[model samples]
Target: MALRLEIFDLQLFIHIVEVSSLTQGASRSAISPAAASTRIKNMESTVGARLLNRTPQGVTLTSAGRSLLSHARQVIQQMDHLAFDMCDFRGGLRGQVKVLAHTTSLTEFLPQALSGFLAAHQDVEIELQEALSDDVIRAVSSNEVDIGVVSTPVTTGALWARPFGRNRLVVVLPSQSEFVQLPSITFADTLTAPYVGLSAESALNRFMARVATQLGGEYRPRVQVSTFEAMCRMVEANVGIGIAPISSVERYVKSMNIRYIGLADSWAIREHILVTQHLEALPVLVRNLAQHLADYAQTHLPGPVELSYGNP
Candidate 1:
């Protein structure tokens, strides 16, 4: 007998394996326990293998089940992407690309880059979200977003990453502050003074918090503000020294009475990268948007002059 499978069955199997309880999985799939059990039995019979090991505790995937789960996820992802593409034919929109990035890219870089891309591709739309670097990587790995822009080095296990831009952290302080005269300063030294901080939830603030913890200290901000510009203004009033990206710092330094100094820590200098599951496997429109972002970064962003970036 030839093996045959249904998409609904595959999706049901995924749901069941994820939760480890057939009843709960059936509830999630909107099918009754009895019907779900029958479907699973049918699937097992067709595949000629036992898929699950069930007990009163719950269920665990057998070796055959693990194999099916992997293929099922891939199939689901492909179907989702296919549906997204087919929608363009039914609707007026040509395509939509989902992108995730950190705060610096969202605020300082992507606004201008996306504006140009949007202007050129009038029929295409982009959905953008701000997240921390780890969250960005997870989203890209799970196929939750079409692309991700992240700072810091990433563990390239299964995902593809290409250098997107170069940026670094800088200390923004009042021009007359005594610390401004120093040639260079570590991140720990900046924490000695009361500092203006970005919103507690922002990616940069969280990153700084982690760095502080690593150095056996704490990040205690004098007052928390929302934007880099706002933080700069707070620094101008001598509220406290603030840390921000060089791109944003340069934009405000001439007008504000604040000066920025580069952080001495090696981690302060970041190589932002574009992340995806598979570059060549992306849809034509998504691949184009990714290329446009890389090209825009090369021309408009600053990076190490000696090294080349982006995919070869």
Candidate 2:
């Protein structure tokens, strides 16, 4: 007779791989190290293979462990949804939606849209995090996040994606700056000048850094700040010119002494998209959040793009 895999074992495996330490993972899962070791051994026995390679430093996933991680995560997510649904049947709509988004979407688009969704679904919670467009897509594909918003073009291989909105990257300069006379400028041209930049960890900064590298240049800022608003303020003080999404620049141009121009690069026009693994397969709470994002885009986005929820 074949032995069966258990949910507890799968969860423990995930915790262990994530922390790279069996002891720490067991502590997080509220189990003793001895019991955790027993469960792991049982799991290996059931599969007829070793999952982890333990060392003096920490544990590393074997090839089988790497393959199992994706499946384990999907199973765990489904089980969690099942538990949440049972609670919902006993009371009201209750569950959390995990979301990953690029910096522009998080800064300009999601706040109002998410606020509206949360207001309507009082019991639903959201866990939002900032990631680059590529990272956002990876998280959605891996089931690490329920929803993802990105500005890059996505191929429909294993994930479903729909356009939600559009934003343009613009160059902001001090009013007295020499470059202010140009109608539009390439992003690479700005790389040669002193720059006011967002923090190094920001998704936008990372994206720009990659672009600069492709153009055989570096994006070293004269000074770095936390927010787009602060970057514009630095430009206003003639600290340095900056580049940011038009949605963010529009809010500050009226009050700040900064001039913004379109970026000549075709990549400057960003088409925002929402990505998910399978809309129909996801929990109702997750589907509702996707619908709310679509509705928000239809109503608020500037362009004449018509988007419907059924595409998901």
Candidate 3:
């Protein structure tokens, strides 16, 4: 009888090769190192050839192993895609969509969009995780998540990305503060004021830093918070002013005693983006969700927001 090679065995072998260590590969696959080694040994026996050579530095793929790596990866990717397609058939739009979003999108924009999506497609489910913009991209690129919504431009590489919408970065101040009367504020106006800064690693923070640099002054934020909500809380308590996406402020407008002011001469716009792995064939459900988001943005999001950013 011909030897039957299991998908699990091929996946284990490929993980071992890519990680260059049975231990690391096992960790990634959530299996014990011994179990991973046994799987590889079984695979070699089935194939009638030694697949890897273990050395002091680490494991190196043998000629046969090197030859099989590409085919193994292709098989694994196809299997995953197949699973997604099968789920789509069974659940329709109700299947799970694992999304990684930035703080602003999670707190401000996605709630309404998700509500509308779920109302229309009662079967679709969404799982959300919040992270910095850069990490959101990484999650989607590695296929750890299905989609990412972030407030930064997506660059070319291993993922396909498009602009989902545009938001402005507005300055938030105490509603009763003396600065409330100003028609517009400049970066220089914020220099001497005690300000709350968003996390330095966030996309919004980088934009604020650039604005300060352009004004030939330093941004001396008295407090730094990780989320837009926290920044608003601080500003409400009279800790300091803050800058965040306008959408975030709108969500908290009624409850929070804060006012949002647009900055004059500041071209700081937050571009919400959707990112996914570059695939020759995308699952029907995933493609449908992407188009839904694009259509929603066109009707709801204000202004002439470009589709892919470059198309602008």
**Every model's TM-score:** 0.74, 0.93, 0.66
In model 3, residue pairs whose N, Cα or C atoms come closer than 3 Å (at least 3 residues apart or on different chains), thus clashing, are 93-124, 94-123, 94-124
Lowest summed lDDT across 10 adjacent residues in model 2 is found at 303-312
| Best-fitting candidate, scored by lDDT | 2
Best-fitting candidate, scored by TM-score: 2
Model 2: CA > 4 A from native: 1-3, 304-312
Q: Is candidate 1 or candidate 2 better by TM-score?
A: 2
lDDT of 3 by residue, 1-312 (tens): 776888888788877887799899888888999998898888888888998999988899889898677667767766766776887667565466778887667766677766777788877777887776778877676555677887655453667776667777667888877777776676677778889987776655665676688778877678999888899999999999988767677777678888877665435466777677653456665666766766776677656422211100
Better of 1 and 3 by lDDT: 1
Deviation in angstroms for 61 in model 3?
A: 12
Query: How would the candidate models be sorted by TM-score, starting from the highest?
Result: 2, 1, 3
Q: Write the per-residue lDDT of candidate 2 for residues 98-208, one digit (tens) a residue.
A: 999998899888998898888877888899999998888888888888999998554546777767788888888898888776778888888879999999999988888
* Candidate 3 wrong stretches, greater than 4 Å: 1-6, 9-30, 38-77, 88-94, 119-123, 131-144, 156-163, 175-182, 186-193, 197-227, 251-255, 264-267, 277-280, 304-312
